[model samples]
Each structure stands twice: as C-alpha cells, then as structure tokens.
Target: MDDQRVSILERIGLEKPLVQAGMGGVSRHLLAAAVSEAGGLGTIAVPGAAAIASELAAARSMTSKPVAVNLLLPFARRSWFEAAAAADVVVTFWGTPKRRVPGIWLHQCGSVDEAHAARAAGADGVIVQGVEAGGHVRGTEPALELLERVKAALPDYPMFLAGGIATRTDVENAVASGADAAVAGTRFLLSDECVAHPEYKQRLLSANSTILTELFGFGWPAPHRVVANEATASQAGPSGEIPFINKLINRASAAGARFTPESVQRRAVAHQSPTSRMLTPHAPSEDLPRRFVEAGPLYAGETVARIDKLLSAEKIVTSLVG
Candidate 1:
C-alpha cells in the first residue's frame, strides 16, 4: 500500500483492508466489535446521537481497537453528527456530499461523479458501492466495473469497493482493481454475531437470486436489492405509490423529532421511529413476525447466493483477509 493509503488505514486502525459494512440494525455492537478485534474495521450503524454514543461505548467495552459508526445522511439529525464526531471514523451514505462531521469521514458513493464530489467535500475516503450491493444500492453498474471507473477518475484517492464480495478471492480482486479495501455486508449478515432473525438468515441461505425493488419505500423511496419474497411478489405491475397515510406518518415523525427533547429523540430514533422499525433487525427473542418477514425488506447482495453457513465475525474477517 502507498504511504497515503497506509496512513488512511492507520487512522482507522485497520490492520487488514477489510471492512464489515455498517448494515443498519444488523451491524450493531457485537458484530462491529468482532471485526475490529480481528483486525479489520468494524462499523456500527445507528442514526441518532445517543444511539451512536451507546453503541460506540458498547463496542469499545469489547475491544480496544478502533471502531466506526455509520449514519445515513438523509436520515441523520444534527444530534447524530455531534455523537458521531467522537468515533474513530464516521461513514455516511445515501446523500449528497457534505462535511458536517469531525475526524476521519468517509462517504459511500455510487458513481464517479459522486466520488469526485465526496473528494471535493474533503472526505478522507470514499466507498464505491455497486448495484450488486445489499440493502440500499447506490450504483447502476457492477461493483468492480464502478470501482475501476472511479479509480481511473481519482487515481490517488483512497477508495473502498463494496458489492458482491463473498470470498478471499473477491477481496484480492478488489485490491488488484485499485481499491484500498473491500466492504462486505451480505457475508457479514450470516455471521453469528449479527442480530438478524434466524428466519431471515435462513431465507438468505436458501435464496439463489435477488431482485431490485421499491417495495419497502415508505420513509426512504429508493431501490433496494433483496431476495424475492412474498413482499416483493405482492407488488404487481409498477411499484405502487407509497400510501398517503405513510407519507403523513413520515412527515409527522420528522416534525416531531425537531420538537422532541434530545433524550427522548435518542430513544425514539432507534426503537419507535418508523425508519428504525422498518429497517433495523428485530431482537432475536421476538418471534419472526410473519408480516414483517413477508413484507419487510430482507436486504442482501448478489453474493447471497454463495453464502451457505453461519460463521463467527472474526472467522469471516480472517477468511476474507486470508
């Protein structure tokens, strides 16, 4: 690695150039700490300031290694940034380039243009996400293809490649293609530390194909890739419009957040917020809500077809690095 790249990695305490993607709800304390402990960058996904602080603290308690926090810029409130600034690294996704963060900040981008924007906005690095990525995809092209394009455009910039990465060879290929690191979500989702419901993990294990749809577009109206399920099948014809009532609910939530006390908002953002309930993984003790299983988004990447067994987060990181 170049000195610049090495410095960037060191800033985030990455001994191995592998990142456990910050999958909302799924990438909580246990999973993040495991990856960090094993030498890769582990990221916790949370939206509000309090949740970010608490999760970071939890991860810190497990490992002295550096940890990162991910916040979806579109959903982040001012309080989120305040809390995230204390983390070793802050990663933002799904929004235009903006640097309201302190410390080393990285932005996940979908295209060359977005990568340039991120660089111009003073991001320490950029994660180029391809269409094949799980959850909310940002790029229209394949992961490697997008990585090559962005690398060509910004040859000296520190970049991470995300999408369809499942094995050690995938990580090697990403590094050979000019990526400083590789980010994996679907592979980590199957890790023992992930909080994904047993049923959800089983569905991923059995799924052989994925589809992009706007079915779970209540709060965030964007195309997300997932295994085909009853929820996806029910949406006949074009993606139906988000219900007016749901729109009202989303608006009300945002409005309510502004007036709500910081302590209350912190609690609400993770549990009661519509976005959290819709996207975050439910507790393992909760029975797999059939309605959610049928309709809620089961985000996975194209690599889902290749993963079959669950492993420890540390094992997953070792396998990818080896």
Candidate 2:
C-alpha cells in the first residue's frame, strides 16, 4: 500500500483510510473483516444493535483490527446502542444523535443544521451523504458544496464524504475540497470479498451508469440509485405521492403470499427522479434477478458505472491511496 494510505489509516485511527461504507445486507462479516484485515476501517451496518454483540464477536474472530458498525435511524427497526458500545465506532444515519457512545458516531448529514445537531449529539465524526448518493440522500446540495459548508462549520470535526465517489480523481478532489476521507459504497459493492449476488455485480460492471429511483418503503421516501431495468423504466409516470407509494408498498408487504398475482407480479420498478438508472441487487445466485421482482429494491450509486471488476480489499485500498 502507498505511504499516504498508511497515513490516512493512522489519521482515521485505522490501519488504512479505505473505510467501506455501510450497505445493509451487503456489509457482512466477510467483507467487513476483509477491509479491516487489509488495514482499512471495515464496518458492519446493523439496522440496530440487536446483534451487535454477536456481530462484534464474529468480526473479532475474523480479524483483530478496528471495526465500525452502522446504526440506521430512518429504518428505526432496531436499537443498537448497548450492542454498539462494544464496537470501535458507530455510524448513524437519518437519526438524531444521542448520548456519547464508546465508538465514533458517523452522523450522516445533508444540511448545515444537521451537522451541528450531530456535533451536539456527541458524534465523533460526520459523513455528508449528498443527494447524488445511491441509497438515501439527505440534502439537495451537491456533494462538494455540502462538504465545504460542513468543513466551515465544523472545522475540527472529522468529515467523511460520500455520494458519487468512484475514481482516484474523486478521492483527490474530495481531499482538495476539504474532506478528510471519502466513503465509497458502489465501488466496494463489486469487490470479490463483497457478498453481493454475482448477477447484480455483473450488471453494474456491465452498465455505464446506475439509476437513482424512488421505490420507497415504510414512511421513508428513501431514494435508491440502481441500474436501468424493467421495474424502473416501466414506472412510466409518477404513481402517486409519497403517502400513496408507502401505502401500496405496505399493502404488498402485509399481503405477503396472499397478494394478488397482479400486485405480486407488478413488474414496474420505481426509478429515481430525473434519471432512469435502476438499482441492482448484489445477490450470489442467478435466480436473484427474478427473485427481486417482489424483493426489496437495490440501493447503489452513479459511481457504480466505473466499477468493472472484483478487486481484493487490499488492492482497492492501495489503489485509492496512490
């Protein structure tokens, strides 16, 4: 690895600066440990702290390096505070920060106020996830603009920039724009260590760009970027408001197997506004593409267009440092 990469790792209190962003189901033990073993900060995105202890135990079994875990606020399905206290770092997205935990709280921010609020919430660091990001966007500001504002406000705060980060130039630009480090999702999703399904990875590597769509579940109108596909391109026009979409998704979820074949078979996938890029799942099996017909939407980024191969965590980290 490059010397600069080593320095970045030290600065972030890790062995490498190449910290992998949280990706729900995708950030499994293998991927997280692989990054950590390679000297970067590897994190497990636990919707809550429910399995924090078990996950941590498993992570320890994989590598003794520092590991972080993500706690999702928007989902609100689980609470991981107690379990997270045992981790080296804890990242929070979409939720108000609470008491100071042992691990770093990487609060995801889109607006200036949220940054300050995260600081007040005892977050050790903050990640500015711009609207261009694949999974969920918190702000309308371009990623660079948001990073600048965040740096001006929280000069001392450790700021990790996400959304649309795909290339080596992206990393260098982020550092010039005042970001201490860059967090990548789509790029890492294609790694060999990544547990994403094979077909999903192939589709991303084969495509020129991924779509940012609006297939929202729960009350969260989370924007997901994916590859252009049948579900996304077929959603011809706006189905309804956020509420309407939520209700429909809720009905579909509740109906389970009882849902009408039409609803279950409803092939229209919601694509992000202003773009046709569709989100592709990271499944290991070829059957996943068919399974996703009713399965959840794939959350990815525009940078995925640049992902073309499966590199090891070490190669990915070292290349970024150079």
lDDT of each: 0.80, 0.65
The sequence of per-residue lDDT tens digits that candidate 2 reaches over residues 224-308 is 5656544445552343122344446644453232222323222333322222222222222233354453244456677776777
Give the number of the best model, judged by TM-score: 1
lDDT of 1 by residue, 255-311 (tens): 343345656633432342223323322222113444455556788999999999999
Worst 10 residues of 1 by lDDT: 277-286
**Residue 258 of model 1, lDDT score:** 33
**What are the runs in model 1 whose C-alpha is more than 4 Å off?**
236-290
TM-score of every candidate relative to the true structure: 0.87, 0.78
- The TM-score measured for candidate 2 stands at 0.78
Indicate which candidate wins on lDDT: 1
Measured on C-alpha atoms, candidate 1 has an lDDT of 0.80
Candidate 2 Cα misplacement greater than 4 A, ranges: 1-12, 48-50, 76-79, 236-290, 293-295
